[model samples]
Target: MDAVSKENEVRLRKGTSLNERLVLAGIAVILCLIALPGLAHLANGQWLGIAALFALLFGCLLLGAALFERNVVWIITPGEILIGEQRPFGKLHRRLIRDDEVSGMRLRKSIGKSVEFTLVFETESKDTLTSPPLPDITQVRKTTLQIAWLLQLPAPELAENPLDAANPRIRLGKPISFKRVRAYRALVVLLACSLSLPFIYALWSGKLSALGIAVWSLGAIMAFVLIRYLYRTSAFWIVHDGAIRFERLSLKGTTETDTVSGDDVEAIDVESGGRKDSLYVITIRLRTGKKIRSPPLAGKDQTHAVQAEIIRRLRLNSSGDA
Candidate 1:
């Protein structure tokens, strides 16, 4: 990754490094070699030959994708910001943001020990245009400040912590729904069923004994328990009368409500959780040191919005109490 600045413009470029490309190429070659014996069995119509075919195809696909990977370039001018993905032949994707349309720049950090910072452009319409993951906080801060200076925009301050950067949407005092939670639950169930296909096949083939039945039953029960624990049927959050309430509807059509009063609330922030920290959730810290968290939200933006709104309402209530 490198950035260049000229009299009238600044340009940032990033792409797959040569060493990474070489490593990928080496892996592809190994995969192809491993598939060679399986390919030879194709003449005898063996199942191994079918598996080999898939392996060879996958290797080729990986190699091709690496070769065609595009270099990301961001060109910032006084009038507009242009972001594009450049291939050897031409630009693959291009986006332009006019200066007038941009409200400000935000430095967003992912939630994890190995944190990544991304510079996001907040538009007048509340939409965000994000940059590629930056290498370090120092570089990202410098880059964001430079762009802000060039555009005559406010230089974004570095968040004291990831939670401090959480900003609520302008629209508050409304219900925030997690409609996608249901779809996510459905997908989990589908995946669990897909994983059980091998056991079902064995049972259908009459190869399972009493022991096999017990094993399958145990596996199914575990999967059900995990899925039930991970997801709720539906959920939403609302701020009303100086408190934030989280309501969850279960599969059994029972509604559970968890409300934290503004007086007891310490802080509201978004945190990453679930499966390698790929999902974000809203966490509320109480004065007593207990933490309440919502289900994995639909996306980081939504989670932050909820966090912001809850914090905003808490502040409003605190002022009222005073």
Candidate 2:
């Protein structure tokens, strides 16, 4: 990541590092090499070989995409702010926001850690233009200040207001539970097994040399690791009786629970990309300055609903004590 400033304009650019790109390119090359043997099996009309070949090629394509990931760039001038993503093919997808349209800018931190931050431009129309997540908040803050000065806008500050919960309380007749099950883990296991099929076949057919055996061994280990990841125990959240509970079920059938009482709750805030379908992180702030966050929940409506109910329960508890 680097920034360049000139008399008329300032430019900020960020992308994958050279070492990261080289690693992805190397993996892509290996996948292509693995696909070569599967090509010969295509003439034999073998279904397994065909599936393996497709999987290998698909993996290569995915790696290639990673190797040439789109680079994010921001150009700030006296009149307007331009945000663009430069693709590997030299195509740029850009958006322009004139100075008149932007009301202010703010920095927002992600739920889990303060390291990840986003710079958001608030428009007069209630719409927002947000920068990609950047790990260094200091850098983001500096860039935000520079842009605000260039655009003649207010200095950016951290956005930390709690989400409004003044709507009618939502009654929960029973405990609300949210389960965490990542479907992507299963997809990864499937892909790993598919990529290993050809090597397994080659070994079974006694056509594998010493080098082939090593590659097959590595594939087997990778498949095992992915399978384990797919079946790993997961945690869930339960909101009930004026408290939020986190429970994790272990593979050995043991369950652990931790609870946070509503009495200590200070506020309920949400972090998101300001989109209806964007993932929302609901954070519970305590009087002690502690924060308990829910896992990334999909959709604005669902997350806001949960937030409202939690606030409702907290109020009910406070009223009862009075």
Candidate 3:
């Protein structure tokens, strides 16, 4: 690469800003400060400060996340596109696609009209590569279209984005999507409160029975382990031209993705469970013995709709193996 090329590489990188990192670091500090009183109470043996324990753990995780939150970066060169991430203590995962290996790209919006969008890239061998759900679709689309032209693939139009309209019916089955962020937050908060209520009541009434104490301990453990998974954004599965891709953010801020070629997936399973509220979850079992689950499905209606659509698109609608 020449000097001019090196400068261009620097120019095109989608980078983590210094200000953004500072703000995250600031919030991490604030959370640690908030956890101090909880630690003091725990030191005094007031176990009632279990809420503070969860906070302290969460704060520490935030501090780590803030410190190492964003390392994945995209770079466009004169020849191809490069996507790379700097891992813990500075290990790196890097993939470079020359113009010839580039197949195609599309924009996916799960919950309509949102800042975050999933950009999918397909290779000649049908491998699926995805960008982490990104907030700046405008810039992403511009870069993607440039690359698409270089590879001689069809351009994914912004106006035809998934969020642009009611999802078209199968052959393009409407995607089963999680509700917007606010809805998920509300549901999580409501459940957390309900779980905590029994302990809170017992604490107030001064009737701390052995069973009551056990219940509180169980609830606290559940909250500490499950809250991160629950409160995080739901994973999304997108199917395009017979290839299916799944993407979600891990609690630690890395993207989790799984892709199965259309032919490799031998079965689609949908099972329903839950008390009063119907919880339907999906598991995709491959001929290779791998099982992939969709982000937990929370509501009755969403479960039904998503199951129907995914099965339909996969052309296994007639089989009810689960």
- Compare the candidates by lDDT and give the number of the best one: 1
lDDT of each: 0.68, 0.65, 0.59
Tell me the lDDT of model 1 at 11: 84
Candidate 1 lDDT over 76-170, as tens digits, reads 88878898987645657998889899988877877554445677888999998877755433244556666787777888877543222232312
What order do candidates take by TM-score, descending? 1, 3, 2
lDDT of 3: 0.59
Model 1: lDDT of residue 28 = 88
Candidate 2 whole-model C-alpha lDDT, 0 to 1: 0.65
Best by TM-score: 1
Candidate 3: misplaced stretches above 4 Å?
1-15, 43-48, 87-93, 132-144, 157-322
Weakest 10 consecutive residues of candidate 3 by summed lDDT: 1-10
Error of 3 at 115 (Å): 3.0
Residues 1-322, model 3: lDDT tens digits: 0011232342233335567667776887887788777777876778746777887788778778766754666665656768787734677888887767867778765653223455677878888877655433223444455545554568886534332213442112223333443465567667878988877888899987989888788877776666565435456766643556777656664567666665677677766644334456667888888887665554443444455556555655456332
Residue 15 lDDT in model 1?
A: 79
Q: After best superposition, candidate 3 residue 49: deviation in angstroms?
A: 2.1
